[model samples]
Target: MQDKINRWLLDNALAHHPDQQALLNDNEAIQAASACQGNDAEKLAVFADHLKVSSQLIAVIDDYRRCFDMARIVFWLVAFLVGASSAFALLTATANHVNLMSVTLFCALLPMFSLCLWLGVSLLRFGQSDSISGGMLGRLVNAATHLLSKLMIAANTAPSVHQNAVFRAGRQWVNPWQLSLLTHSSWLFFSLGALLGTLFRLSFYQYDFYWGSTLLDSQQIAVFVQISFALPAALAGIPLNADLIASAQLDQSSIQTDRAVWAQLLLMSIVVYGIVPRLAFIALSQVKLRQSLKNLPDNYAYPLFRQALKRIKSLSEQSQQPMLAPRYPLPADRAAHTGANTIASIGIELDQSDRWPLIKEDTVKDLGHLINSQQYQSALTALESLEKPVDVLAFCSYARSPDNTTLKRLRNIQDIAEGRVLIVLCEQAIAESHQVDIHSRLIDWQTRAHEHALALVDFDCSHKVNVNDVLNAAEREQQT
Candidate 1:
């Protein structure tokens, strides 16, 4: 089922380019067999645990997609209704011997005019998720930042091809919501406005007015009649009609009056049903996220050496326990230190006895090699070996990345591990986090793991940062 869904996503994404066909095919296969799957209690327990994480990630992506589609549909429907109402007023006025120019002007101008205004407002107000910039500046800034980061990472790394692969992967997994918002919002504004304009023109021909004699004289009832019907039409029509000045002499007073009332009602409905509800949802989501972050354990101030000692003890205990033996045990007496040249071959240095020094270039290169080789066991071993608490980073091509595997590994470590784990990621690679709903799910995991002594390190590398300065600062602080 998961493979099918992934393939479907690939198929849709790749419809315009046949070159991606092989990449998608490979992804489907990797996702099928990479994670653990079994019926044994421990294995089941582990699988179920990872499955929950996978499910959360999938749900977030699905929900965002669902919202995108829904927003599009609603915008179109509203625009159509508005246009139809405008047309109805125009036709009714015309049937009552209203000026042909006035009727034509109102029908043509009203829908088009209002649509432009609405589109402007929507474009200004709506934003893509994870976008640092809100409008034109944001799109430009984001693109520039991404390109620069990719170029820098490529320039600094050896094996240029591998670096390129990582950069592409990072781009793919990083901005799912951002892309969705941009595409869906644009579609909603244009398509819906067009539909609404057409509907209003059609409605104009459907409604007409009727009159009856009354006891009140024309002079006595003139004010009342104008106020009752013409006021609304005037309100709804004036903002929409470009030629309102030229048609001022026509008796469109009744139609204008009706339109004003309908427009007011529509505004009220939107305020009540749309704007308010969305605001409430945003507030609620923020509150929940805040509470979750606050509840995370404060492991920052703890002495790094002491924490390493504690981790060693915990790992030792778990390894000896019959029911909880290490899934993949390490060599009993592995060397704690390696020469600079041998570092990549030895992988991550997890032994607490030997202080793990921060080596930026060595770690990054080794990680890239491990990931490319599909040596997850070696990668896990390497990650576990790290003594220093610096953030770990990885990249995968969007079209041919091990994003799901990386996500699963992170989830498992967060869930079962006993110490702080911080994963710093580039902006281009952050889309998977949104797609997997990492924020909410991580919060939930943190909540559940509170009693088990776990802490999460937030490496929010997606934000703009001075990479060299950040690494230097971390190194200086580690030395302290």
Candidate 2:
């Protein structure tokens, strides 16, 4: 997963170059990659391995990876320390007295507020396609990573313009949800650090806890304390009564001062308010981030990646085709000069049981079937030995499209014939249901014939072919 992202990022960076062919379209490399059996990501990984990505761009990617990892570590470490220091500073009481309201608010205030904001943003942005922006914490982490990446680049004495541009693009590909995941994890660490900090302060130090209020009486303060600390106190098994609350007031001198109950209430408050919510959001952020990564390629807006995918598909199709033997060239110098008007008939790749057209000429020579290389060579040899300017009739089935091998064979026959060659599309065996397919095949043959400057004459075995009439039709089609 780590290197896959890097390779894709590098490929995208290379695609933006003006000379794409020189940079990316290496024929042998493409063929090699296409030969591998796998999905797009696996094949693209092979392709990237074959291509020579620039060393500077490679360095930039490596640098980004290092900086991102380091920034994650540094961010969490800073968050933990900040949490610990804030807890330690607030818990340091003045004149051996701890204010209950100030202690509760200091531990719960920032984490609760930020958590509410995160929950609101998450609900509003759920299932949205945009990954460019995230919540406040996510934005802060992204900014920090970006700054660190720049510093890493600056430390290098000379960075290429190409590397700089690719760096900018690669950084933009960062998913905001991934940053949000990091943000949630950092908060989790902060909560853990605050918990440990609170335990350490309360375990080692002794202080009297009290509340002083100018506007409210002790009864009102008791009511407020009961309402606020009800859940935490219940979970901690600490009894909260009006007598205990009134005795903890500053004006009322208390002979009973066991601060253990107050410490338990504070720890429970930090856990319930700070730790558990961050943990839940961290899980939610992780799930969203994974989904975003899984759908990354599909959501890529660049045409170049799509083009590269298409190119891979085309190359794979080409690679899967069966290898074919080389086509033999036509016999050169087979022209005859005896001046006897003759007709030579040959069927290419046709069933031997199928009858050839009955030609009304004494000089007609049936050169058997030209199905394989040996048969083709023998027919060409016989035609070379002819003693007249012989016109050729080449027969092919109209049941299927003319493939490259079939076209090549026709071209070979045309080259060696003395007078002229006419393609006879034998359609007598075709059924009426395949008439539409036959018409399409005929159109394809006509286009191929036009390309090679050959002529065509439809042949039916039921009809007798007049040598002169067929010759005339072939000549007319060739001229047109």
Candidate 3:
């Protein structure tokens, strides 16, 4: 879907004609091009071909996407650095002990505690999942992208709106939660670093391993060990014997101990408890991230697609017709020397208060009667009853795309009216957000009129009419 939207964007960018470009942005155009045609995959392909969007544009967009992914990866690595550094600071070597309990408590169990807290929070029904970048990491990534965009814009001598738009799109598609897939990866790296640091110290110095508590005895400590490392310790073939527990007691008078066995237990506990499960969770997050990236947000639906769709559907229907359009009887000459006043302005189902013809000059005349598409047959009957030939100024709302029924109704007006017919496309003052590519509605009417040979194409409602253009055409008709 993103590809289709971007392709349509490229087609609009490459089009030299402003109207065609605007049409490409039209929601009607997009729907016609992509939807109401074929199955999902086929629809996008046909839409792409219809627009003739350059493959180069897709490649450029893909390249930018790859760069964004790289930025996210870098964010993960930086976050891992923070975690690794924190692990080192908290688990630094303590006073010499017969037991390495201090290192295990800080490096191994501490991370497990943090991981449990994180998991518990994540499982709650929050409105949205928080990204790893929800904190300082987010700020850093935003700052980085901002700098990159500024640098690219500043480096270019000539401003290309397409290029700027593409850059802006890159910023738009960057999903922060998508990068949280690396959360477990960062924790894994931190745990591995802590383990490596412990090993490095153990190689240089021998520290005995034992357990001691003010309330707990050796028998209780042995029971706890068996429960905690039950499956993994058993799978690793480490025997959980009474002698091993007694040897591991800190207050015991007997100093005899199998140091190798005790070290293996602590090391295996970190691998089983800290690293492996985290790696699995990271994989799950990656799967979820991929799915999230594939889905576009609802607001992405184009607003102008209805008009473009109407144009495409109309064109298709016209092609299937035996005659492109029904022929009308040869009409009489247009009302001689007709001005805006002589021309009766008719609003098609427009509101009584609609400020249409927006400007009512003394040169123009208006009946101010709003006729709907369904009431067109009646309007035609009334036109036929007019005393003399007078031009009919027809109004069309730009807010709605011109449809087939509209074309048929216009034909009805032309067939009955003796004078020239003109279509005045009406629209409210467009907002800045909608200013881009909004001329498609006007062009759609013009194209439809040209196709069926019904009415004159006047300027869109937003603009002041060049009355001289109308007068000149009328004068030519009078001369003929």
- Candidate with maximal lDDT: 2
Report how far off residue 303 is in candidate 1 (Å): 20
Give model 2 RMSD, 1 decimal: 16.0
Clashes of each: 35, 0, 18
Model 1 TM? 0.23
For model 3, the superposed segments whose C-alpha errors exceed 4 Å read 1-64, 75-99, 126-180, 195-207, 210-232, 241-257, 290-295, 298-300, 315-480
Taking the tens digit of each residue's C-alpha lDDT, what string does model 3 give over 1-480? 566546544433333222345545444435344334564434433444444333444554555555455656676566556545644453343433545455556556766776776666555635564433422334455556555545544554423544555565555444554434445665676677666655665566665667766676777877766676565568678987777777778777765557777666677777776788778877876677566656544221333333444555554454345542222322344434344324555666543244655544655554445555445555666666664556666766655466677777666666565566666655534311233123444556666766656554434455545545544653453344
What is the TM-score of each predicted model, taking all chains together?
A: 0.23, 0.60, 0.47
lDDT tens digits, residue span 1-480, model 1 = 434333232222222222333333332222222222432222222222232223333333343334334544554455455545654454455454333233333433333343345347546656843322222322433454455544444434234433333333334432423333332333333334433443454345333322222454443334433433343344345342323322232334543324333333233332332333334433543454344334433222224213323333343343345441112111222111212212221112121213222234443324433333456566656655655332343222222232444455644543322223323222324434223323323333334323333222223343334335444443342333
lDDT values of the candidates? Answer: 0.35, 0.67, 0.54
C-alpha root-mean-square deviation, each candidate: 21.1, 16.0, 13.9
Q: What shift in Å separates residue 466 of candidate 1 from its native position after superposition?
A: 64
Stretches of candidate 1 exceeding 4 Å from the true structure: 1-52, 94-480
